[model samples]
Target: MDNTTTEDTSDTEEEILVYAEFADSVNIEKYNSMHILGIDTKTPIVQMNETFFTGTYENPLGTYMFFENDTSPQSTDPVFDRIPEKNVKYVCKTRKLLKVEHGYITPKDGSGQSTQNQAQQAQEDAIKMVSFKTVQEALDKFKQEWCTNESSSTDNNINNLKES
Candidate 1:
């Protein structure tokens, strides 16, 4: 009588469970090791209610995977400003431009506010500008902004050409 237990190790890469949200949709996916985590390599394609979305740097597929000891891009040492802790949803910060040409910020208390506050406020405003629940909504907003702004100037140019 032979009592031998054989273990099968067929695949090298281990599958991990991940919750990813983007394009106004959420997914519980089994992450494959072949995934390239970065801005360039498009991955984690999603289709929700007939609309499709691909992971990009600007609109990334967020997950809970991040190195706790990873340093900030600005600095290589000192453990960075701080690594995002586990279970805490980290927001991708959209910073205001360091300088805006011919731009002026209204002062509070008759004095300029802190740069950090200014930058944070700018980001909040930008977030509100394009906040949408779905892709169609975003597209509609873009169309309205794009089409309406150019039409007035374009019509004037055409009228001038006809008059000339």
Candidate 2:
């Protein structure tokens, strides 16, 4: 008889998390545009029902977007700045985006739990755990890298066409 235990070793890396808070729907549109234009690639893992947005960052320890709100949760770092006071609505940590059933976003996991239950769980986990400085930093870098060059070339071509 042999009484031995084998340990499981895997090479899976942990997913990075970032938190962002937008003041309104316009800011959310800007964020979506930046994402579509390839300016921001962190791909939101979860978005709270309200303004909070959370995603994965390539370098979590380095520069990343950070949200600040007096009524929100506090992290270990002192890099965040408090802004207008407002109670947080929800915090979602799941990787998949919420399904849109009809006109409203639904949390239909399709597993075994009820949609309401899943949504409640996501909301409960929506507090800001990690801090980032500014989401604009990454967008600015992306614009400088891709948008500027492309726009300049496009303008040059348009001017040349007009001259011809």
Candidate 3:
């Protein structure tokens, strides 16, 4: 009797897991390999929920995944500067054009006090601005008018109170 073990390649499938280090400054060698695979450049290569940033760079050749290093864009980066700027514009900034032209902000200190006053004024204004031919109309108008402001106010408060 002849005993032999036959190898089966047809029914067996090999699984491959590929991992790469992503950073703003990537190794060109690694970048080339990922680019060949057709990954999106802006999609994150790694992330820890705001701690780490990952994405890709798109060039004529292809896309290369990247991780944001210490030198890369950050939460404190200019994009994030928008929050404070917006807050300043909303709460603490007094503007000649905005006040006189658009009437967005009153000609006052534009501090927290002004913000509160403006908010109350806005509520009053909304109530005055919304004319209800029917109760349903009023309700719908109120929902549309205040829903975004209410949610955004809460979010802004929470974001301001956040430690980091």
Candidate 4:
């Protein structure tokens, strides 16, 4: 029956996909990307095939070489020694390679960034502790005391009143 055939075909396709995934997992350790190998630093990334490049991989020399296990995410490591040359390869300039030499790419949060965040939090805490008796009184006092500069007119008036 047609229904029976359809179910069998669907089950077969599912099994094929699972088998392919399992096969890829087995070879995962051997696979590495041209980018993770630091090939992008020295060489440009390109796709040569006019056909759809569903999955692609290359060595340092621009050769078309597919890894046995390419299911893993791209690598973060920064070096590669082998690349193959391909006929359809195209080349273009790339961004400056980030110097990852001195452990520049790291997991540590920046001390300065965190320091500023803490300082801001402390400032907010200090502001919350201020218990002004009244807004108008606070504002009047703030205006009189905010400027450290001496007022010559006020000084002269104070002297006149003192002499009187």
What lDDT score is found at residue 13 in candidate 2? 80
Clashing pairs in 1: none
Per-model clash counts, in order, read 0, 3, 5, 11
Per-residue alpha-carbon lDDT of model 1 for 67-99, expressed as tens digits?
333343343465555533433434444321111
Clashing pairs in 3: 22-67, 23-67, 24-67, 41-56, 44-54
Weakest 10 consecutive residues, lDDT, candidate 1?
A: 95-104
Ranking by TM-score: 4, 1, 2, 3
Off by over 4 Å in 4: 1-104, 107-129, 149-164
lDDT of 3 by residue, 86-146 (tens): 2211212211110001112234574889789989988887844446699777655655666
Per residue, candidate 2 scores C-alpha lDDT tens digits across 1-164 of 99999889879886544334332343344344232111145444343234333333332333443344446555555667554356453433433222111122456565566767889899999994644478666544544666456878865664565469
Q: How does each model score on TM-score?
A: 0.19, 0.18, 0.16, 0.21
Best by TM-score: 4
Kindly list the per-residue Cα lDDT of model 4 for residues 1-164, writing each as its tens digit: 35543343454332110001121223334534313232223422322222111222222322322234333334355376333332232333322222222112345589889999999988888854456799777755654664335676765654565469
* Candidate 2 deviant stretches above 4 angstroms: 8-13, 18-62, 72-164
Better of 2 and 3 by TM-score: 2
Tell me which of candidates 2 and 4 scores higher on TM-score. 4
1 or 3, greater by TM-score = 1
What does each candidate score in C-alpha RMSD? 25.3, 26.8, 28.4, 17.8
